[model samples]
Structures are given as structure tokens and as C-alpha cells.
Target: MEILPADLQLYLETHCDIEPEALKKINRDTYLKILKPHMLSGHYQGRLLSMLSKMMAPSRILEVGTFTGYATICLAEGLTETGFIDTIEINAELEELLNQHFKSTNVEKKIRLHIGPAAQIIAGFDGPPLDLVFIDADKKNNLLYFALVLEKVRPGGLIIIDNVLWKGKVYGDAQDTDTKLIRELNDSIAANPQVEKLILPVRDGLLLIRKK
Candidate 1:
């Protein structure tokens, strides 16, 4: 379920700021080598992440999934001078590739890659108060991740969850486990009094939650 037609998507990309050269290479390499290349947030979504980060101007960012480190870089673009991003990726196989990609960018030092289950790592995260979080990891654990990170987010901080639309499966009969979990998380967030939320029909979908 493409919210925008291919032609329109391309047109928007053309008009937006050009993607960083390093990101462009990573996008190409991801499609060529990764099993689920679509998981990588490409041009439009990457720029969206960057734009949101810039708007927030967060001092600390947490990324639950670092697939190819594309979105990680995008989010880090708006970090304050002394800020850093702690990104967790479950697949150990991607560690080397992720590091290699990071090394090619100036933001390398600002990104700390943690290769392991995000749940466990997040459970022990005692870093600086988080000003922004990007949750794009396991769908089944979306609720748990939101709970774990909510308190850590400074009041008025943002938590952006990707794939909430789950390719529009969230709208129709969602028999799959992942889709069901996403819907549950969406509903729970909507009803929760702790945060302000909105769903954006970006790439797959992005649920933005601002901690109150």
C-alpha cells in the first residue's frame, strides 16, 4: 500500500534536499545485498526522519533498530553538539556493515552501535535523558519498547514509531501477528493519557508520540 504513487514519490524526492552521498550509497548497497532491503528507510522516509529530528533539535536520541544505519544517520543529523545516538540492532551479522557505513560519515562518533536484543539493552539503558526515540524494531514488542522508553523521554520529547501502518494492513483484516500487535500498540497509544499522538502516512506509517 503505497500512499503515494511511484511517480509522485519520485517527484517529491527530486524536489527535497538531495540525500547525503553516504546515505545514497548505503541505500543502493542495501537493495543489492540485504534480504529485506525495503526495511531500509530510503530517500523520502530518510529525509522525513531528518526533518523531524531537525525540528525537535533533540539532545539525545535512541533508535531501536539500526538496519543499515540509514535512519540512525538521519535522526542523528539534528542532534545537539554534545548529543549522541544509541542505536540497537538485533542482527549481529549487520554489525560490521553498519560500522563500515558509519565510518564513512562524519556522524560516526555520535552513533553508538549496540549489537544485541534491543529489549535487554533498553532495559539496562541508563544514559542521559532521551530527547528523541525512533522505534522501528520488532513489532510484537512495540508496546514494551514504548513503555520502557517513555519515562526516559524528557517531557515534550518525541518518540517516533515506524511501520505502524504495516503496509496498510492495519486498516483491513489483519490476521498476521505483526499487524495485530501494531494495531494494539496504536490503540493503546491513542488511549494513553501520558502522551500526545498522531499517525502520519509516511512510507509504511509513522506514529509520533510526544511525552507529556
Candidate 2:
């Protein structure tokens, strides 16, 4: 899953801005309390998300997958004074742990946690046009999630999809279902004239698309 060499990854982490205390706790707690800790965005990618969120200064943000809320906290850091984030997670068991961390950091106020089927929940999603959206949920539904959020995003808004590379499995023939979907999503984004896209080899892979 790590595309970068250990030394280089360490160097990159070492050179980046110090990880915030709140995010540090999320990073630590997720590893300790959660079942697939690797799924949490971790320090490097968390910082990347935070950087992008701050740069965008989005008024409204939508996070399609909220695993232990690591990225949720990171993204919330960059919200405008009145900005808010709606983060959805499929696992109901994580609701308490997520809220606990959010409350501990006071980010709970800026985040609205929704627990249930992401697609169904997204179907009812309504608010100001989203200025930023991060989709890191079910791999198979990547296309569906993209379609659901595309029109809701403001022009020039960003949609960042994680794991686009699928551990390099997307490079050639997609032998599995998830790989095929991710590959298809990548191709679909590349072909779409409605958005400008780039795939940053950060962590697994981050496919960044901006609505045109």
C-alpha cells in the first residue's frame, strides 16, 4: 500500500508541518481502538487533506466515508469560521468513538456525523453547494458516489477520491471487482470534460478532480 520507500516516506513526514495535537490523538486512538487501522488516513495523508481543505477554505464540505473520523478532523481544521462538514460512515459501532474524539477536540461542533448507507444518505443530502468532497468509502460504489456528488459540487469545487491506485492493481488488467471499479472510475474521470483531474501518489492514491 505504501508506494514510497521507507526512508523517503519518513523524510517527507519529517519535513512536513508538525501534526496537530488533535489529529495526533485521532491517529493514535484509531490504531488502538479501530479494526483496520490502516484505513485511517494517518499523519501524512491527514496533513495533505488538511492542507487542501485550508487552501479551499470550503464553506460546505461532504465526506463520503468517515473511518474513525481521522480525515474528518483534518478537513474540519480548514473550515471557514461558519463552515461545516457532513461526514458519513457505514459502521454504526464507530459512532461513539468518532464523536468522542470529535468532542475531545471540539471539532464535533463543526462536524455532522451521519451513520448509515452512504448512498441512501447522500441521496437525501441537501444544502449549499459543496465546495469540497472527499470520497473514501466502498470501493465498488466509487462511480455511484462520484455521480451522486458531481452536480452538487460548486463549479471549481474539489472532489478527492482515495485509493484510486488500489495498491497498484489498477496499472494493468483489473482482475478483481474493486480494482475494475477503481480503474473504471479513473478512466471515467479522465474522459469527463466536466472536471480537471490529477492522481497524486500520496499514500494509496488520491484522485483529485475539480469541477470545471
Candidate 3:
């Protein structure tokens, strides 16, 4: 899904936020121990997420996919003094590793990891308005996820959707199920009048939607 050339991507990471020692350990362990380590937003993207979080300094953050807690910790770096980022991971098996890494970063107290389908938790949530949201779970549910969180996000809040490009298939003629789902979501976002959006051609793609 990496559109950038290898050398350029490497250079960007080198110049970006020095992946902290704790985050470095999480990155290394994710590659060595987790399946499909590519899904664990690595150095460059993690730094971008961190930078965005720092800029927002949001008090309520929601992350749909908490793969190995890599991005989770990154987002936690820029929370309000009393802020918390609630994340959902469907796979219960990774709970142990997720908790271990979260603890290692000492951000466990700032993170609330929910184990189960994201739709349930998001739809039932009655917490304060969210200022930031990161959606990186199942591609098929991207549209549903967006809809569920839109009402909860305060006006002017940001909802960042990862992998909106679906490895460039969304723009291609590939009519595969996943690509079609992504395309539908992208088109819907483009047509929606309640928000303004942009697709940053980063790793895969990130569609940033800011509510009006």
C-alpha cells in the first residue's frame, strides 16, 4: 500500500519525529510478533498522527482500530491533561500484548481499550462529544463507522479515516468487494454537505473530514 518510493519513505521517517524509545520497542515487537505488521501504522504515519493530535489537543479521542496499540500510544501523547482516548479492537487474542505495550509506555491509564466490534460501542456511547476520531478498522464498515461517529463529534471536530484508498484499488477498475465499499464511502464523503474533506495521498490514503 506504500505509494512512495522506499528511499524517500525512509528519508521522511528519519526526519520525522524520532520514534520514542517506548514506541520503538512497540514497532519492533509488532513486526517480529504480530501478523500483518504493515497494518500497525509505522514510523512516518505514527508521527503524523501524533502531530495531528498535538495540534488538536483533544480531550476525547476515539480510535476504531487499536492494532498492537502502536497508534493508540501515539494518539495518547497529545491528550488534554484529563483527556482519554478510547479505542476498540475486535480481536481479543491481542489484548494481552496490547495491554503490555500500553503499560510499557505508561499511557495505559490514558487509554481505554474496548475488545469487540466497534459498531456496538460507538453506537451505544453516551460520553462527552469527541474532538478527534481515527477510523482504521474493517474496510467494509468504514461508512457505517463514519455515520455512527458523526453525530457524536462536535462541530469542527475531525474524523480521520485510514486506508480510504484501499491500496489504490478504489481508483482502479477493480470491482472487488473491499474496493467498492471504500469507493462508496469516498463518494459519499465527497457529496456530503455537512462537512469538508480532503484525501491526503499518504500511506494508502487518509481522508480527513472536518465537520461544518
Best by TM-score: 3
Question: How many pairs of residues collide in each model?
Answer: 0, 0, 0
Rank order (by lDDT, best first): 3, 1, 2
Q: Against the true structure, candidate 2 has what lDDT?
A: 0.91
Residue lDDT tens for model 2, 71-177: 99899999999999999999999888988888878667999999999999989988689999999998999899999999899999999999998888999766898
Instruction: Please write out the lDDT profile of model 1 over residues 20-61, one tens digit for every residue.
Output: 999999999998999988888889999999999999998899
Where model 1 places Cα greater than 4 Å from the true spot, the runs are 1-4
Cα-based TM-score, every candidate: 0.96, 0.96, 0.97
Residues 68-162 of candidate 3 have per-residue lDDT tens digits of 99999999988998999999999999999999999998678999999999999998898789999999999889999999999999999999999
TM-score of 2: 0.96
Which has the better lDDT: candidate 1, or candidate 2? 1
